[model samples]
Target: MRIQVSRQLLDRQLVDVDGRLVGKVDDVEFALDADGVPYLRTLLTGPGALGLRVGGRIGRMLVLTAERFVTDRPMVPLRIPYGLVDRVDSAVWLRIRAEQLPTSPVEEWLRRHLIGRIPGAGRAGG
Candidate 1:
């Protein structure tokens, strides 16, 4: 199937099989076959990818802001293989569940430093 990367893929929300929010398609990875035909290899998500795709001062700030949360010098983005994508409709549907994916460092940081400090934050539903 033919796809318009910018129009259909980029900035689209990624939804797992369970309908859980995964992330957005911030950037993409491409590879060339033996025949020299380029193909989309991976879908990258997270601030790192978004920042790079955006580029310039605002982009650097975006990444720097997220980097402050994690001890890692350069934050790693969640890379979803194109093969793992079951479909791409209104949103990109994944063949796996969100639990199968690694937790975002930014999210984890917020949970530990901010959200976890909130009263009753540990409890689901009020």
Candidate 2:
């Protein structure tokens, strides 16, 4: 499909087959094909990718704030290969379930550190 990356993709929500909110399309990666033609290679999501895409003081702040909750190491954005995308309409739909994708580091950190401490967090719909 011929997609208008800026108008149709950037900032769009990413939903998996099970209809879970995975993340947003923070940035897109491109790679050259055999003929030296560029094609969408992967979809990147997370503060690290968003920060670079929105480079500036505001972007740096975003990265810094998210980093504060984790380790000293730099954050890594979640990468979704373009082939995994089932379709793109109102939202970018993935062919697989959210559970199949590698868990987001920031998300794991927050759940373990912050959300995990909250009462009733362990239960479903709590």
Candidate 3:
């Protein structure tokens, strides 16, 4: 199915089959073939990448904050190759579960330092 790069594709949330929030489509990668024709290479996400695309001071702050989470000076965005996408609708669906991929450090940090501290944080309210 043909999907518009701007509207139906970009900025859409990516979810696993189990309905977990993985992340959003921050940016996309494209590559050229032997014929010199370029195609979508991968989907890039993570604060550093999203921030750079966003630009301005807000972007810098995002990168800086993300750096604190890990020992790496410059963080690398999660690259989901086009091959892994199972389907596209309101959002991008991954063929594999999120547990198979690396967890977001920021999400882990916040959950550990803040969210997890709250009482009954482990339960989901109906």
In TM-score terms, which candidate is top?
A: 1
Least accurate 10 contiguous residues by lDDT in model 1: 68-77
- Report lDDT (Cα) of residue 78, candidate 3: 92
| Candidate 3: count of backbone clashes, pairs at least 3 residues apart or interchain | 1
CA deviation > 4 Å runs, candidate 2: none
lDDT score at residue 28, model 2, on the 0-100 scale: 95
- Model 2 reaches what TM-score against the true structure? 0.91
Q: Across residues 73-98, which tens digit of lDDT does each residue of candidate 3 receive? A: 68899999988999999989999899
Q: Work out candidate 1's RMSD over C-alphas.
A: 1.4
Candidate 1 lDDT, 58-123, residue by residue in tens:
999999999998897798889999999999999999999999999999898899899999999989
TM-score of model 3 vs. true structure: 0.88
lDDT of 2 by residue, 22-89 (tens): 99999999999999999999999999999999999999999998888667559888899999999999
**Could you tell me every candidate's TM-score relative to the true structure?**
0.93, 0.91, 0.88
Q: Which candidate model has the greater TM-score, 2 or 3?
A: 2
How displaced is residue 122 in candidate 1, in Å? 3.5
Query: Which stretches of model 3 miss by more than 4 angstroms?
Result: 117-119
In order of TM-score, best first, we have 1, 2, 3
